[model samples]
Target: MIFQNRSRCRENKSIFRAGNQVLQHTHEYTYLGLKLSSTGNFNLAVNELKAKAMRVFYMIKNTIRHEIPIQTWLKILQAIIEPIALYGSEIWGPLKTQDFSKWKKEAIETLHTQICKSILKVNRATPNNSCRAELGQHPLLINIQKRAVKFYQHLKRSDPSSYQAEALRCQEQNRPRSTLSQLMLKLQPDQHSTIWPNQIIQLQKLNDITYWKDATKSQKKMELYLNLKRDYKPAEYLSCVKEHKVRKTLTRYRLSAHCLAVERGRHRQRWQPRERDCVCVCVCVCVCVCVCVCVCVCVCERERERVSECPLSGCRERTAPAEVAAERERLCVCVCVCVCVCVCVCVCVCVCV
Candidate 1:
């Protein structure tokens, strides 16, 4: 009985161990499957995060590369972080959700730390001197600094509360407003005068002269003429004018000249070659010549082949003589026609003369 009880207890323990092992294996498999299913999403998230970080880094590098102003760098940083903060609540979801709050807090903290560190890094990286001193110097930074100073000054004047405190604090700390302004004030103007003494004397003399009275009289006469011109309507006034004999003479001369030009242009246009007709004639001539040449070649080739293959020797000889005679008769007819056309042209020319 004691052996059986011990055996039973051992069996129960062994079963429990096996069951636990199976459960462990099942849990591991499930976890692994879940991870595999979400792997693509996880990788995408990581890639996006890395890309954002790279973009921010590159932006900072470029800003520094151009020797952009510290204010500009600050503005860039602010712009980057502002949206993140503004959308944090929506992005993180409700605070009641454990996953959201925890993730949001962690992300915000990490970003905040990164931005603060980046700001310090950028400030340290910027050059103390002018851009010309270094290769690949940033002009954007210089412009940003100038704009920032202007903005600060404007704010100081327009709204003391917006800028006075900051300026006073900066002054107390003995900070320089800008390097350019300091350098400009330190620079001395060239001693040489741009204008000569004689020119100055001439300008003074001209200034002393009173030409206004004569100028005023001429201006009044001009104004009166313009008023008379404006008051006269072209169609109505021309009809009303009684002494238009001189105008009529001028009008007749202009009309005759215009009519002569119009007639000359009309004659010229009538004689000019029509482009479309010329193109059509050229195309027709080319097509006719090509067709005739092809027909002549084909006929000559067939005649030669027929002569070569002729079983009867007298047949080629008889046909050749007849063909030659016919060709001679055709040429004679063409020559006679050309001579007749020349004779007719000469007779017509003699009659006209």
Candidate 2:
């Protein structure tokens, strides 16, 4: 593949000969699963990664029940989806956060938030910040940054005479925006380091690279989780959930794969109204009819008492007719009241069941 501007690339006739055969020109190609584009950017690779991750995510989503614990879902995402999305990020991940690169970061963040919202069974309208806050998940860009750094560290620790180490040296000297240089600039040998955007953590001992990496990551995760809790308002669904129970469940699951998925499922179902109009209508109608019958009986007994206490001798003879008229009037009122009550109950159940 040729790396050039559109006009120049179109003008140039690119060909290659291997053995006795000639190779055709191509604008882009995939090497070791990374797509190299003539456009001189990893945009295509990032997009493909995002697409692949989403495809895997959908397959998981369809195959597994949403009733899975939040922690399990998170593990699935980190183990499966994130690996796909962050594949080869070591090469392209550390580009200075610019237009397309920044957008790619946001895109990955969006995917992470989407998965979080799904796991929590929250609405699509839930704010992304709140979603991340609720789940205690750091922005995915941070992971990409870490991957890039670890790869840089691996190269530095590798054989100096090796091709990869030599390339790293060349990039460090020539390319300021290269992954190695970027990691050097961000993670200087200091008391602390800034791994990604807005994240700062102490790195008192860089000699022990593995230990330092793990310590910094844990500290950053805790700090971010706390900051989010203190700053952002919880999602509507989250706010309605029992705070203590949620925290306990999340903590338990994070510590170990606990079988407390049903707790969250219960909370979600509580907030989610199931609108079965036929069932609600039947229930409300039965209730209203029973209530109205009780009221009608009371009214009819009162009418009978009034008729029996009549001062006229003909009142006794007229009791049957009077009772019939009163019964008719009361039945009309009872039916009207029952209908009104049933309609109101039905609407309430439909909206807030």
**Number of the top candidate by lDDT?**
2
What local lDDT does model 1 show for residue 317? 51
**lDDT value, residue 158 of candidate 1:** 67
Candidate 2's displacement at residue 213, Å, is 25
Q: Supply every candidate's count of residue pairs whose N, Cα or C atoms clash at under 3 angstroms.
A: 4, 0
lDDT of each: 0.37, 0.62
Candidate 2 at residue 334, lDDT? 74
Indicate which candidate wins on TM-score.
2
Poorest 10 consecutive residues of model 1 by lDDT? 128-137
Cα-lDDT of candidate 2 = 0.62
Q: What tens-digit string does per-residue lDDT give for candidate 1 at 292-330?
A: 566556556655665565555456555555655566466
Q: Which portions of model 2 miss their true places by more than 4 Å? A: 8-11, 96-105, 175-179, 189-353
